[model samples]
Target: MKKETRHRATIIDVAKRAGVSKSTVARVLGGSPNISEEAAERVHAAVSATGYEPNHLAVGMRSGRSGLLGLVIPDIANPFWADVARGAQDQAAKEGMSLLVFSSDWDSAKEAAHLRALRQARVDGAIINPVADNLDGLDRFGMPFVLIGSSAESFPDTSSVGSDIAQGVRLGMDVLLAHGHAQPAFILGPKSKLARARFLRAINQHCIERDIDPASLHTEDSDYTVEGGKEAMSRLLERASKGRHLAVFCANDLMALGAILAVRDAGLRCPEDVSILGFDGIPSGAFSWPALTTIEKDGRKIGSTTVTCLFDEMAGRPEHGRVYIPCRLIERGSLANLLAGNTDRLAAGR
Candidate 1:
């Protein structure tokens, strides 16, 4: 037998149930303060009774706003970006707006496509970590937007938000210094990238302040990944003087985890043989072999604040400017068995 179709409740049904004009029901549902409280109450009751739901498309047409926000990020799987997306989503909900999120996977073409799609959808605003330097597409669309991530710093005139990378590095280094690990090593990004430049500048300043030789610092270039970090760490360990409290700072938690693995792979104990410090306070790091000490960048704050900036742009209020949120250092077992006591896996695995 053919199933009978169910009719969806409409604004008219709500108006009829409330015993008010359709315009009055519309005004009440649209949150117009001009509507009488009595009328609004009746309309709300009628809406519940009739199971009335407004057509979002129709509402957008009437208000000249889609009531939607767009986000385009480098990697959805990365825990940092995930937190960012969550923050933006939460903020959007508070303002009665919907969020549309996309991951560009570090592809410029894909990034461009997502931006175009946002324009086509007529999103009220967007937050993007741009993959391409050229942003002619944004100019053409005229949709209000905010840039996010360390790369956002490159666009000085754009409204943007990101972690204070240089400050975070310095904070991590200071901890190393206080702990008497004067000549700390590093697993950094490739020099061709902006991230590497920021890291180098911070490292140089820290060295200069303490009268430490910049040339004496041992550093290796690696992509921001566990495997890359492992390889870089392995090379650093191989060439270094044999075993005397070697400390290495990783660009991110994933790389730090990799470094830990490399030490273990070489039959060396973490913290005892080498101390590790990381950036980007991913939640998973807390549960690592030894909890990873890190410079914690507030990704959620970056995301939510970016949304706030987008709103300002949407309203044509604040002029464009970059916002840098400060990062804090979290010390744990990886900094040499000080905080989190660890059951040495490298020894046990043997």
Candidate 2:
């Protein structure tokens, strides 16, 4: 094969184009606040002209702060995590930083591997939603890391940001109760984070207080996907019997959409035959048929807050403890009176 030549530009090119010393280019890339405004503008113009993307690896080797953050999660496909990723991305970009992402798929071994990889990448910090509660391996790494949405049996000095799902679930339950739903079926995702479990327990407790027998409450588990929600709701309906007045609360909006599909396929009407409630008010939920009634969490706020905490650590501040992100409920048309006409008619002909 013939040799192929590729055009590559370096910091020297940027400095030459900007008519500045190489040190000045380096300082600009390092985000030195002391750089003069006019000088900064010239360096930015030169950088754009030369299309010189810095050698981040070499920079990381030279300085402990790589201006890079690593975010590890289970699934990017999940809207909840997608929102989390958005938050991290927004925060990173705002701080003139970049991010490296890894999905552990709920596997400890994979999580361990990513942790080691991030260390080698010399990231400035990491925000991880651990696959499970195995913090021993992470604790031993002794790096600047924060946890998001999960915790361990014995955490050793880590910062965390997680949704208050317990409060969220309680709020959903209270909303359903206010809307005259006495018996609502529950759909839970398979992930067993402390927050999720707490929400589950709170909702179950709420049922008890409402005189619902444990056996009478329909419940099922899924893999936290839209398809999983659909199948689980199908199973719930099969076991609970048809024509029974019911409401459904899903662990997430994706699941709620799935359940809504299942309910409609069964020729039952949402909010009419069964009111549907979901957690994590993803944008898609709003445009969903009849509009989904769900809880909304400020994902961008969480992301920005997590980055702020990470910066504190980078600045040599003490490691942080847990941080809680509040949740809110949004009532829409997905929830309706039990006696209302078949929502199938409203949902149909779409």
Candidate 1 off by > 4 Å: 1-6, 33-36, 133-141, 337-350
lDDT of 2 by residue, 84-151 (tens): 88888888898989989888887889988998898887788888887776455565555787777745
> Looking at model 2, how many pairs of residues clash?
0
TM per candidate comes to 0.90, 0.84
The alpha-carbon deviation from the true structure for residue 70 of candidate 1, after best TM-score superposition, in angstroms, is 1.0
What value does the lDDT take at residue 196 in candidate 2?
53
Indicate the residue-level lDDT of 293 in model 1.
91
Report lDDT per candidate. 0.87, 0.80
Error of 1 at 147 (Å): 1.1
- Clash totals, every prediction: 0, 0
